[model samples]
Target: MKRKLVIGDIHGGFKALIQVLDRAKVSVDDQLIFLGDYVDGWSQSSDIIQFLIELSEKQNCIFIKGNHDAWCEDWLSLGGTPSVWLSNGGQKTIESYDNYSDEELERHLEFFQRMKNYYVDDQNRLFIHAGYSSMHGPEKEVYSSNYRWDRTLWETAVSMDKKLSKNSELYPKRLLLFKEIFIGHTPTIELGSKEPLNKANIWNLDTGAAYTGALSIMDIDTKEFWQSDPLPALYPDENGRNVW
Candidate 1:
């Protein structure tokens, strides 16, 4: 059987996400894996969450929690300005949920809470929202903080050495157990560069959709990729303001 189709950070651009999935022609039997960041940096967080929930019900949808999703919940808890979300294209997401009842909000929170930290298939295709720490073993260790909040780990993964020292607190060897790993967090210069150092093993798929970059999806078995044109223009005119 073919491996599942994995997608990079969505950042709440539902229109582009739908287009990419349609282009991929994902079927009911095919597995779909999301690398996280389902909300924030786009206007469709609410719709995207609802759509993903529906998708999960109909098909095998594996979701990993992203940094932005963590921030959204935190912001909501503090009654903070979703402005950060809005500036990053979250206004539309808020608009989408304008009619949602309190119960629906609870359901959304529940779904977010239930999202996995990582996914490992039978083939050893590991999927993590952000890169894993080198120190921990392969038993799915949980971090006290959200994966996105760990800037040190992110910077270390993208450092000049590329390899986090085995002795370092956050080592990559722990994840060496997997034949191959797929992740999203740090954005790459291009979709699939061959340079191991330049090409993050994490398989960054975010593609900066909110910043005029393409939205991407990869077929795990074939390593084939599909992308939508950059949608950077979508944010400026949103709500007739420079909110994003």
Candidate 2:
């Protein structure tokens, strides 16, 4: 079967990424949908980007732009350094590219620039780095940043009355926009579950590989998931995101 798998935020945990992919037995025939935040946190951000660029050449992959990725892109392309980004793991991402030549960094910048804000499949399944506030859908969003930075969509889904029928007038129209929505930005670790979470029609795949949690991947159709060992365990000397 050509499985469509949605992956969570990587946060530069390349080793963890490899572990989950291997465990999932992913093949070139499978479609890989990455939820982004490919950089910032661990020490292997640059390596991960390079690997993804290579992987995409032969495998079916969908890359969504993430907030962290946007920050890295600015730094790489314009030499801009936002302090907020540096405080939130951007420094490590910069250090990760120490060995890459200028041309290689440009390649990475191009990769980041080409990422999508959101993707909707033929089945109406939405794959985005974060949520969109537009009731109509991401296409109608007013603020482009919301596609990668908004949390309201997930909050609404999480707080909604589970018993409220979809046909109810109070039902969230945003949730009704898609058959399924896969997102990564908010880590599931903060929710006290180091596993993918499902609320309403939204599936949050960020298991917090940026923090002390694990990397996660899921079969979007089967809902079967595979996780890597705790990211901290994979990189013992590095305090990823230093969130602990």
Candidate 3:
């Protein structure tokens, strides 16, 4: 059978990412989908991007863009921030690319810009960086910015009636076409909480590995979920911080 695996927010933790992929034993034949946020949080955004590029070249992988990535690109356009990024694990990302030239940085940025916002398959499984916006009416368009940055819309959509919620002003009525939607944003308290409040059909995969959370992945067909051991502590520099 063809196996499809969806990985949650990476947050630049290449080490944890490798570990999880190894554990999952990702094969060239398997379909691997990254739920975005590959950069930021862990300090290896550059390395992570390079690794992802290599994966795209070698395996069946699809990349989605996350809010953090959008923020990082925007931040770079405004002016690269060593202090801000480093403070929130950007240091690791910088450290990963210390040897790269200006050309390499530009290439990485370009790759990030090209990422798609969502991936929908015939199995009724939908993958997006963040949840869909449920605030607008049926005719309202879903924008990329909403996919990456908006949380209120996600909350509202998941909490509202499934049928009615799909009619959200922020999301297109076409989205109701799917049977199930899988997403990775708002980190859950634990790997897989049973409570509806802690868990939604949305399937949040970010276990908060960079902040007392675990790196996670889920198999679409079997609904099997896996998580890496949590970090000993929040990266010391990322205390009470949010960016990256």
Candidate 4:
């Protein structure tokens, strides 16, 4: 059967993304979901977005909007770089497109603007960038931005009891609402892990591809995984984002 594959934060590690996907031997027939943070690290933010745009035409692809992506989109649209965003790896993204033409940059901006904040599949699996603070699902407008900027969702999951039956009323409403949840904002490294982590049915696939570890890709069904070399090895010449 064609597999459902989910990719973690890429953070401008274009070469790493290519490597892991190649290693996984991902075919166009397979369903691919990129959890976001495709830019703002390493030195290929523009290249990464371009690659995914072309890749989408060749395969089944779903893109999520990440906090970094949001900031980048705002910068691209406003034409002003904010210090806060720059400190959080936005400078690397701006540098990546230093030579791009107006049309090319426009395409990337469009791609960023069109990214999904969250997606719910037929299986009720939720795919988001950073996740939200609400336990009532993604419907509430108050916490909507949290879909791409929140970490409390994962933190709550990490603190919950995964052993609890899904049907149990005590189960976290967030997890209870979906068959599974996949996110990428908070790197696994933050959880003291260098690989993908599963807690309370929430899967954090980001393996610190922007800094400390490799890019990761996992089969959503079998839970099998593949990774690229450490991102530094892939972009040895460039100093990617150093901050969280």
lDDT of 3 by residue, 133-244 (tens): 5434212435656676656535654565645544467444434555666677766644354211222345667666556566787777787767666543434454422522
lDDT of each: 0.67, 0.94, 0.67, 0.87
Please, what are the lDDT tens digits per residue for candidate 2 over residues 127-212? 99989888988999999999899999999989989899999999999999899999999988788998999999999999889999
* All candidates in order of TM-score, best leading: 2, 4, 1, 3
Ranking by lDDT: 2, 4, 1, 3
**Which candidate's lDDT is highest?**
2
Candidate 1 wrong stretches, greater than 4 Å: 1-3, 75-92, 138-142, 151-172, 190-200, 233-236, 239-244
Span of 10 residues, lowest total lDDT, candidate 3: 191-200
Error of 3 at 77 (Å): 5.6
Q: What is the lDDT of residue 104 in candidate 1?
A: 84
Candidate 2 Cα lDDT to native: 0.94
Q: Can you write out model 1's per-residue Cα lDDT over 1-244, one digit (the tens) per residue?
A: 5448988877777877888888988788888999888876666778888889889999888988877777666554454555665665556556767888989887787788888877788887777777655445335446645455443444544552656554575555544566666767666534343111123344556666655565788888777888865555555554322322
Best TM-score goes to which candidate?
A: 2
Clashing residue pairs, backbone N/CA/C < 3 A, model 1: 41-88, 42-89, 43-93, 134-170, 134-171, 134-172, 135-171
